[model samples]
Target: MDKAPDEAKEVYSHHGVIVKKLEKYNERESACSSSTFISFVSSGTLSVLEHNNDRWLLWVPEERNLSVESDPTEWEVVNTEKPKPPSINDEKLESRKIWINVKDLKSLQLRRNTNKMFFDLKDGTTFDVVFQHGDAQQFISSFRSFVILERSRRSRQKFYVKGCVNRELSKSFAELDLFGEQGNLVARFMKDLHDRPFETTLTAFSKLTGVVASGLSNTLRPDDEMVSQPSLQGDEYEVIPSTLDHPAMSLPPRPTIKRGDPLSVEEWMRHVQEDGSVIKVDTLLMTIFRGGIDPVLRYDVWKYLLNYIPYNCSQTEAAELRKKKIQEYQTLCQQWRSITPEQEDRFSLFKDRKSLISKDVNRTDRTIDYFAGDDNPNLESLNNILMSYMMYNFDLGYVQGMSDLLSPILMLMDNEHDAFWCFVGFMEKVMGNFMLEQTSMKEQLLQLACLLQILDPVLANYLNSHESGNLFFCFRWLLVLFKREFTNDDIMVIWEVLWTDLPCRNFHLLLCIAILETEREEIMANENGLSDILAHVNSLSMNIDREAILSKAEAMYMQLLSNAEQLPIMACVTLGLPVPPDPETGDHEEHLKLSNMTPSDDDEDAFEKAMSHTFL
Candidate 1:
């Protein structure tokens, strides 16, 4: 006969009990009652379910036989708003919630004698959960390990190395030159422990803690050699064999760009076709890949990159198209400016948009010479163009960062009509970033998360472990394509190259990866939390070396190509590149390219030529 399942074992068990406070007053009990019982949740079972990519859920059921671990659609959800203020006494001033986030939990303590568990939350509220004696011990033991592991994960960000000594291991591991290896293992161990709540995780956490605590206790002089060793008797300081070999914890080499590398007008001239038309998209892309266009040539080159003038359009044809586009822009502007207050009142959205546009135009790039000074005509010009854009695309309206994207284009173009049209063309590439409901931003961030997971799983895991896997830190970077991160002149150069759309599509995403690559070591070294990482990235504004970013981004693109077979499908889709061959049939799947498909030359000669030239 088959053995019966163990009734004592917790497998989404029948029910668990929790006590909630009551709101109604009772004269006798309320006279001295510090807390009132609202309802006893005796029909529910507690289960942990993975929520978004970065967080887990501790759900309670309302009725028996409810499968909390099943589809999330079936699970009762909460708004993700901040928890309510703690009550002076545990009173049920509100309706009961079926679940509370594991993230909001600050601590969990158990009173073994009373078989009750107390949950201390980040919002300063406490909840009392009661269970039978046997169930209480098991729940406390399991949940305690989870809390300790989470604390250690978050605490990792605070400790940093000083003078080559690992903060966690102190001088002992440094003397042995085991800091890097041991640190990596512990990170992996922590990651593994947090991924699931099992007996194995508890066992691993116990061992990992002992090892980390032992390492933390050591104090060794700089002169101490490996031979002069000290021991903490009865301490389990040995590394866990399983954690030492995690492949994801190994850090990749940081990207680098050699000095004195900037593309010049002379090299750019070399790639122009004989008819004065731009060369094949590939050749122009190669030219602009680094050392962006010279300032003098930016105005001319930008037209082709922005596709205001087609790749093969002759000078005569461009002049004709320019006149027509000017007329087109004026017509659109006049249509909006002609709108009387009477018509605008009927369409409240239009009025609201105009007000928002006025506020943004007043602030956009006001510090720059082009838009500065009292009643600057250029500022009015900026305002007019944005207001015209509102008329051109009434649906998108105006987002806060659109001004940042348009500022450089206006600076490069000579007239309002030209600037307006150029801004229109530029928006085609990035407008999705400003779309309603943030659908595009979410998609891009998800794509970025996928790329990071492949390139650096350790960093990716750290971000997810800290509930920051959404990659919202990259919002500004993507919103305006790093417009705030560089100066006006530098932005002109960067924008023109990005317009080329060569090597791969969505090259901006690659640029994001490139920037992250340069800072990966420091990020890992500091073990920065989400806030620190966001601050560090935002602080990089105006300090970035554009050429280095381009170089490293190029290098990363090549690396992805080299490892195409192992690349994730979403990455290929994001890059607008074809998916690699299927292992079974050895057949490749074709994808329609979203951006310019022209392949750029990845030769070293251009890099060499750029480095050799000295700008006069």
Candidate 2:
């Protein structure tokens, strides 16, 4: 049966499995005119439980019984109905506004019943996601739907893209680009959540791997007016286009993000609060969305959000230790101010540190001051972002590049509270990179570099010879999650796709894969070295095509030799995501295996790297 009967009055999830009943069907010409009663099995296999009254039974995916019945108390029948899937006929994305109709339930049908969710990225590729929602750790234990959205050009950032939360799952469904008509989906799993959803989404898609839709014309030339507008309702805050967008053109049109865009953060929170699990959402996103009319008031809202996440956060008595640590940290900031450069250098955390500033030598005072204070319409926005992020992420004290991440979000969400919360959501996955320990960031760089070497020995050799073997120069690309590369709108698409958690978060490794893939032909021809490769790679900012890179990247993801255990690291490598790699063992399966068991090398290594380093 292609479609179920309308009278399927009952449905529920059974021990991570979905089960439903199809009511009477009195069709006279039907094949099973009398087989009326039907029950959803553990899988797609639907057997005849009770046949009567001119009806038939069916199930999707056809698997054996393994479903646990719902709790009696939780099983209640209501008048809610299941909607049909939407049909998009040869749709083409234009100017980056591929809006999925919110009120239309039919449009949300891209979810594949077989897995939690599916994405057909392009032509013939497909991907699967075991989505999660709720408390961070419980995410794996609880498989809510997830999806990643892409947002960047010549760079990348990933965001979680999905529908509004619904009653049954208590979370919204993620949307994805379906490909291959059927069965062709495959990409490296990008990210996982031990923190907020936005963090997971943002980290997974972080990349500076491709030429985004903005900043480049079809001919691979810099489009003079390529300066991107704000993501949502970015009209009022449009600053004159930065000279960075085009060197030759004196002024590019300040691309503006109009508020009229569907499902802005404002709408997301409203729907989030409407019906769903009571997630510990970033009050910042909420405040920004609520007070969008006057983004100037975001600072006030930031103070309010500072209330949402208690500064001295002691959720339990064990957390009291957190307060003492905070005091110790504040003491360090104070002590550092008085210390000389050499004195502070002794402490690894402050050595040669640059406070949230760019390393780009050419950037002028106008560049820094332009975005810094009241002159920058987004200055207040940036303040709220930096301040709230500082309060929210004490583990990673304020660092360079974080402002890049905040600036984009600030552009999209003028309100500091909202920007702060969205940034918090973003930082959940990224903050680890900014931490004093710096191990996660180091591990990610190494992992990506390793992937690049494995995937492209030629390029690896070139980079190696030039002292770029570590590929650490890509640090900026990773640090702000590629904010330095693409325009803000591009960041949204990249991020939305990443949030899905499909393939898993280490998806950026795929970017490394894709970058190598796209340049394979060129690398083969150029015979470049590490230094030459560095220059070539850096100069690719305007010559890339987002679609081509992603397609190649998706292909690379399918070819990589990843393991279930490596999925965590894989997630991190995708978007500057912070997957500590079990600093002890440098493994994940061991962590899962030893979760409640004895410590191994991985445990010791993690302890040594994250904790003992304090002594170092």
Candidate 3:
């Protein structure tokens, strides 16, 4: 490593460390490309330096003529005793140097029976490094001196840092007896404090101070009023005037909704005619909207929902369509499979796409039995489907989240041709999310923000005031349609419901609102900023109540309908409801005209147009 600056303090230094893997972080995209890859064996020196009162972990590659003395903290120049000018290669190597803020480190995983360690950062950057000389113990010992490291209970190999102030706060809160006899609330608060430091601090202080003020107010109240208000609730005791307490800020009472049982094989068969053509398509869709198809029935029902098999087709026609589709799929698959080594060598984009597809396929849903185990046939099927998709839709090619979208379909279909077509059908509805400019993704987030503002302004305002108005924290939820937020089976139900496009257009946005509503109190109580919100939202993966969220989202739709007359045109457009006539114009033509205008128009017109296209 380079010598520390005169004003810097060197805490630790180690030599013979090699960076096995390094990739740039992109929160929205999980796919890795060739440009981001580092050579397998880039030998370097790792050092921890304290500068400007903040510590940093840095790695610098070994350079000729650089030498270290017996003292670990000291550095010296050898041979010519003078530094040489850096060449083009040296500049390239210097750009690869790793410099990470110690505080930004989220967790570290030490591989068992090996000297390699994986470092994960809060911003999603990851580093795979191996100690070439001694083991990683020496570095871990040095790191413990700067921060408190605790092994994760769930993962024996993982260690995370805990701040001293957070630990002290937890201890202080645990000793307090003010909460209650059981102190359950205090225990919960302490646990939250330990998990999230800054946000928990603000929330705890806010609630505690409110309680203190409320107690003082209650003590000063007249005996007559206390006797007269014996049935008053805690919120009714507040004497403060706050905007959030205003009646206009309150949402409609949530309606109770119960989900139906899954669509069984018998019920599904009842809808089919002797010709194999489905009858009462609208009723069938409604049945699916209320309750997802049974897993055993998904193989047959999904094809119809995905439009892979036309509902109006007879048995013979459906069989013919299947044969044609299989042939077409095979042709597409062969396009890339037939690419010669020489051709791939020259076609960088094709090679990159193939490389990304292969990498993602190897890791996609590996824990699932259908796709697990080394050399699993399902893995190859996934790779083939994605590669075929690239040939089928060359413009869109393969994106990071595509694997997630296809895995379930392939597993359910258990056939490569059907899964490929089903994936294409599913992609048709969501292809906008994977576009190069990500215009659809941004529009979805904007629509989600708009909905939240109308449905729950209090939470929306909180987010706006805290620099989270963009709602980017919910990006993963929208991008993969909540694939990461629910269990495998639950995701299937959610996807089937969304595919129906019933109840309203962009119902998925309402789902986002529903989840936010469920998390509203905990979020406002424990989260204070964007990062806190993101972490809390991400930690909810696979722990969500799917049926409850689906029911709540549907209830929100009902609430919107009940208040349709008073809602703004933007809200109506977002949910695919009829746009109310403009009072002054006495018709909605002018609004539609404005909404259909080009982006080159003024900002207001552009926003209206964007909102109009949110679901389209």
- RMSD vs true structure, all candidates: 18.8, 27.3, 16.0
Question: Worst ten-residue run, lDDT, model 2?
Answer: 169-178
Per-residue C-alpha lDDT of model 1 across residues 112-182, encoded as one tens digit per residue: 34455555555655555555335555664454322333322233211110011112221211222211212
Model 1 residue 414 lDDT?
61
lDDT-wise, the better of 1 and 3 is 3
Candidate 3 backbone collisions, by pair? none
Question: Model 3 off-target regions past 4 Å?
Answer: 1-252, 593-616
RMSD of 2: 27.3
Error at 62, model 1, angstroms: 26
Residue range 1-616, candidate 2, lDDT tens digits? 1222355322212223223321332321132223332222222322211111111222233223332243321212221233322322333212211111111111111222223332222122222222222221232222122223322111121222322222211111111111112111122122222121233222222211111111111111122244543321111432222212222311222222222222244543442332332234444343232223133433323322323233223345324543554454445445534667677556433332333222211121124444544345555445444544444454455654466666655655555544555566667767666653344555566456545644555655555443445453454456555544444555544443343343345665565556656776664456554445445565565355544554555455544433323333332334333334455566755433322111132453332222110000
lDDT of 3: 0.67
lDDT of each: 0.54, 0.36, 0.67
> What TM-score should be assigned to candidate 3?
0.59
Distance (Å) between predicted and true CA of 492, model 3? 0.6
The candidate with the higher TM-score, 1 or 2, is 1
Q: How many residue-pair clashes does candidate 3 contain?
A: 0
Q: What does the lDDT come to for candidate 1?
A: 0.54
How high is each candidate's TM-score?
Answer: 0.55, 0.37, 0.59
Q: State the displacement of the C-alpha of residue 326, model 1, in Å, after optimal TM-score superposition.
A: 1.3
The best candidate by lDDT is 3
Model 1, stretches more than 4 Å misplaced? Answer: 1-246, 249-276, 525-527, 585-616
